[model samples]
Target chain A: MATVELTFSALPAHVRTARLVATAIARRTGVEESLLDEVRLAVGEACSRAVEAHRLHCPGEPIRIELRDDLGRFEVTVTDSAPSDELEQERELLRFDDPLGQLPDTLMTGFGIAVIVGLADDVQVYPSQKGMRIRMSWPAATNGLSPV
Target chain B: MDLKLDHHSEDRLTIVEVEGEIDVYTAPRLRELLIDLVNKGNFHLLVNMEKVDFLDSTGLGVLVGGLKRVRAHDGSLELVCTQERILKIFRITGLTKVFGIYASVEEAKEAHGRDK
Candidate 1:
């Protein structure tokens, strides 16, 4: 098993660093290059959301990212001190359907989470005293996962 | 992330080269650039995504937003998508039919040629 932990100051540069770490870990785990890109993109998006949440609700807080790989499976978790209601609202906003609406201009940017859920095998959300935790997993098989 | 902005024949064609992942975080930068270009009266756009590695819905939204803004002025937005992952995203989002997607920047230039 391999693990990497990083903490950032909820700043934009840290967000990019988190993505680079996830990409490197995904490549080290022998994940398909394309799948690795997808994983990295998901991690980046989730972390960005957390950073945005922290900036809005808990300024000056730190963002934590934990990535683990155990041969056939990979897990990425992003944590920050923010309200669960925001995450729930994000999830809800993404679930709405609007073929022609201005999704980008709105707060529906959480659509990245949906893409992550679609590409990964498992997605779990936990609200702790520390903050909201978002865990996403991908299996080696890469089969039977639902599309976003 | 590296963004290259070029203006060809004032108010006619503008090409933007984006090399990086276009997600929620990085998309704002692209949005600002594209919107600023449009606001400056440069409507026609050809986004060269040959070097772009990844794009999500936010990225898609940026493209869509640019398309709408350009079309509002009777202009058009074209794309040069060579990367497999980026192509897959366009195919999955049904945006392949929405934008004038070409195999290379050359083709995109050629298509814009006819438009001009």
Candidate 2:
């Protein structure tokens, strides 16, 4: 297994870089093309949400991302260093499942988790000692859902 | 990456040609452009996304915000998108039902012309 770790300031500009790096790592795992697109978007959404959370509650701390390629599967973990209370609040806002029509104008901006969940094959969230962590993973070969 | 926006006006309908990735970093610029157009009384808008390679929730949020802005003026906002990758984002968020998505820019223009 190969692992790559990246730490960058929780800023919007850095989100693009994070997505590009994650996509590169995923590509090397020989994942399907369509699944790679999902990986790109999932990583972007995760980093964007983390950056927003850090901006609101925890500033000056860098967001950490870990990419692991186990030859058969690829995994990514995005960690945010917000305080425990702020992390809880952010998780609540992100885990929402309301339809778009039911959401208020202010809440329409909070669809990061839904995007991630729709793309990744598996997702897990946990409260770390420093803050919170979100892990997303996908198999190297997705079945017939994608074109061969 | 940054966004590329090229717009032209025809009879009150403004068509914006958007290319490149649309994410958190680039979405704010798109949002500002749409707001400026709405502020200048350009309401009926159709964004051409045939060239947009990527879009996330932040980009979708800007489109939804633009839709609300134009609707407030009794106008409409639509999109010209053919790519499955970009369309999937809209479908996943249930935005396909909210915004008018046409197969081509000409189709969108003809529909609006018929409405008038």
Candidate 3:
């Protein structure tokens, strides 16, 4: 398994850089072209959220992202130093069948989580004392991300 | 890439042409432009997103905030989007039903006239 690691200050400018790097690695890992956009969007959303969290409370902190390509699975782990309570709240919100079912008002907000869920094959959220770790993965056994 | 925002007239509509990416970093620029247009009494807005390469939730929030701004003036905020990739984000977020998305600026203007 090969892994690419990235760490950057919690700045919005670095979000695109992160996306570009993630897409480059995902493509190299054999993630399908059709799903490239998904990887890009998912990474952007995750990075943006981390940046927001850091800017709010832990200014100047670094956000860490890991892109791992195993034999049959490719995964991204984004670790942010946002408040643990905020991360827990986000986890609870994800439990909703349709967090967007509320209304356009609420829909316009907290939309990134929904986007991540739709694009990734698997999503795992763990709120740690430091902050949150969002694990999103796509399997390559499908000739998509992981190789058989 | 960065977000490039420019506006022009299409019949009775004000078309904001967006290029490049829209994320948390650049979305505020878009929000400011949309709000500026509204503040200057330009309301019938149709955002032309043909060249928009990327859009995330923050970008959508800006669009929705613009919509609210125009709606208060009894005006409208629509979109000219033909890219299926961009459209899918709206669909997944349930925003496809909120904004009036057209394939071209002409169609959006035509639809605007009919609404009058």
Q: What class would a CAPRI assessor give candidate 3's docking?
A: acceptable
Q: Give the TM-score of candidate 2.
A: 0.88
TM-score of chain B of each: 0.89, 0.98, 0.96
- Per-residue lDDT tens digits for candidate 2, residues A10-128, read 88999999999998878776676779899999999989878877887777999999998765778899999865454455445642343333333234334677788888999997765
CA lDDT, every model vs. true structure: 0.72, 0.83, 0.83
Q: What is model 1's C-alpha RMSD? A: 5.3
DockQ of predicted candidate 2: 0.49
Clashes of 2: 0
Regions of model 2 farther than 4 Å from truth: A83-109, A127-130, A141-148
Candidate 1, residue A64: Cα displacement in angstroms equals 1.6
* Over 4 Å off, model 1: A90-100, A103-108, A126-131, A140-148, B9-11, B21-26, B56-58, B91-94, B109-116
RMSD of each: 5.3, 4.1, 3.5
> Which residue runs of candidate 3 sit more than 4 Å off their true CA positions?
A87-109, A141-148
Q: Give a tens-digit lDDT track for model 3, residues B3-94.
A: 89899876668999999999989999998999899999998999999999999988987888888889889989999999998998888777
The fraction of correct interface contacts reproduced by each prediction comes to 0.30, 0.60, 0.60
Ranking by lDDT: 3, 2, 1
Q: Is candidate 1 or candidate 2 better by lDDT?
A: 2
